[model samples]
Target: MIDEKEHGDVMEIDKELMTKIYDLRRRLHSIPEASMHEMQTKAVLMSFLRENTDLEIVDRGAWFYAVLKSSDDRIGDEERTPIAFRADMDAVCGQDGKPGHYCGHDGHSSILCGAAAWLSRASQNQIINRGVYFIFQPGEEIGAGARLCRDLIIEKNIGEIYGLHNIPGYPRNHVLTIDGTFACASTGLEIHMIGTASHAAYPEAGKNPGPALARLLLEIEELTEEYNRSRGFVRMTLIGMDIGNANYGVAASEGTLRMTVRAEREKVFAGYVDEIKQIAQNTADDGGFTLDIQEIERFPATENHAVNVDKLRKCAADQNIVVTELAEPMRWSEDFGYYLQETKGAFFGVGDGEDHAQLHTAGFEFPDEIIETAVKMFVGLALM
Candidate 1:
């Protein structure tokens, strides 16, 4: 259970700014946009920055990052590394099949925006040591948005980055982080097998792929078990399968199998994909059938730098906020993995409370109270 007493200091929010942040979050929630299609959300954010902050904006298609330079005159005399904070701005469809802010991205975006507002209002002399960047990313659900921002990150010479997600079932306002791998690599695979269709009465004249497909499925299961035993992690799920149509009197000619492959390491995930393809080919060849394989989607594992993780812990402790080190990396995948690949950074989680609905659920809602907590964490990281 979360220690409620530890939340008091970290949950403080400026009443006036809280109103604006809430308004923005609700506005964003009302008009939810899917992954690559966040035009309206982008416009709202840009308008807010123009009206409220005096930072420079660099647009990159549906995403953008705002830069706030430090007041220190040493900027030109000596190069100082800029720190970046990223927030995803896209909403996703809920279990009810409707687009909404069930994933709490609306809240996440507002928290970052609040930090930007604070930085904008601070006096020039206050930002002396390091520059700051706030990145508003889109298409996180499809796992392409973070990769698109790679060029901007490289061009700006950002030395380190930080990210956050609100996780339910933990104590409200508490921060959780992990060392080393934070999330697993995942990808969807599709396999198609083709054979000759024939009348059911004359089964001998036509080739039915039922037996072959069954064997392939068993092989996949065995492979998953073997990988789990060897690598200590594997999640292979068969999400879809179709052997033939409803025609009762015809022998099956076409079959399809779809599955998701996940592993803690990128190499292990790649090996799983390759081995699955080989199994598909060998099975098809043995049964005199044609086989095809396709990858539906892919996301790399998110790894946290030990140094960054330690910094996060120190920052949290300094603010009197509770921190928990996770025992294992999350099995889910995140697009933010791409950012960590190029920069020294860490992605941590803030608790949304034990009673809150789980993420991606139809009833899940981003609690507005956590906005202040997230803003505090971002501000702390920026100044650290």
Candidate 2:
């Protein structure tokens, strides 16, 4: 049995908690670790989790799974139906060469840590339904980290789960989410144009791969527009055109283009990928270039659970939270979709203040005001 008084007795989502969350976010932001190299992040999260819950902490490389139990492994109705709250803990490889917290993942981590601490202190009478599992996930930006926790959830018998991510345009101290607004499918794509290297003087010998890459990039805009019209949620972006092998002496033998595609529906997204392949093949054929297309990461789309959606909707309603249904759609993606794939859960957005610059971009800071708003909402959801 949890100590409800212990949970309720402290922190009223006041200035103190806000300061803590803010400080945590900043500290994490300063030391942004990319993808699976989140050892520092894992250590900090484990320290926080251990200080908060009585649950066993299982640290497996890039992921940590903490299970909070009730009645100490009993039979019948006493058996805990585990619930999970997860937060992704990887940083973006910012363009500035400085580790950046532009993704607001740092904030997401602090909020989850805060929630775990608060819920762990809840009273026996406050143990409304079942067990609580705090999942501090690593390497979400790279797409496969959640796979690290796949077996652990099934083995631990976790029933339902939920996760939170921050949104840029939404007002701080408010919440914005529509049940089916977020796209669950996304991937970062890289296609390399490889050809024979030859001396610049021998124009007939070397196939400059740069021209093929140029053609490929030009065609992508049309493909993106088509996807916008047909799939609406499916979108593609070509990010890089790297042909730096410039020396009037040697013909460019290899070129590369970095791209990403995102979609609300998986099948539609698959169609886009197939279409992209066709485009690349045709482009390569004409330009005498060989293409090496490899996906950097695949982040599956998130489908909100019917039950969790209803629960959060009601909770937000009770709190008079501001809600926004997407006018168009967002191309951003999250790995939290992995948990939703396995269990009944939903990933949601909390406002980061309208003025805040977009996430994953330089100059974006996790808004200080949103900290309390997030903490309160988690408390409300947990206690309920």
Model 1 ranges with Cα > 4 A deviation: 1-13, 73-79, 95-97
Best by TM-score: 1
Score each candidate by Cα lDDT: 0.84, 0.73
lDDT of 1 by residue, 85-108 (tens): 999998887656667888999998
Candidate 2 local distance difference test against the native: 0.73
Query: How well does candidate 1 score on lDDT at residue 88?
Result: 95
**Cα error of candidate 1 at position 13, Å:** 5.3
TM-score of each: 0.92, 0.83
Cand. 1 TM to true fold: 0.92
Residue 11 of model 2 has an lDDT of 31
Q: Which ten residues in a row have the lowest lDDT in candidate 2?
A: 1-10
lDDT of 1 at 183: 86
lDDT of 2 by residue, 1-384 (tens): 132344324335445545666777787877888888888987887786676555578777667877656543431242346667888888888766556677878888898877766666663444545667778887787788787876766876777677787887776766655566454588888888888888888956988878778877778778888887877667677787888465878888888889888888767777888888789988988887888889878988776776787777766766666665555445677777777778777777887777889877877777766766676666666655
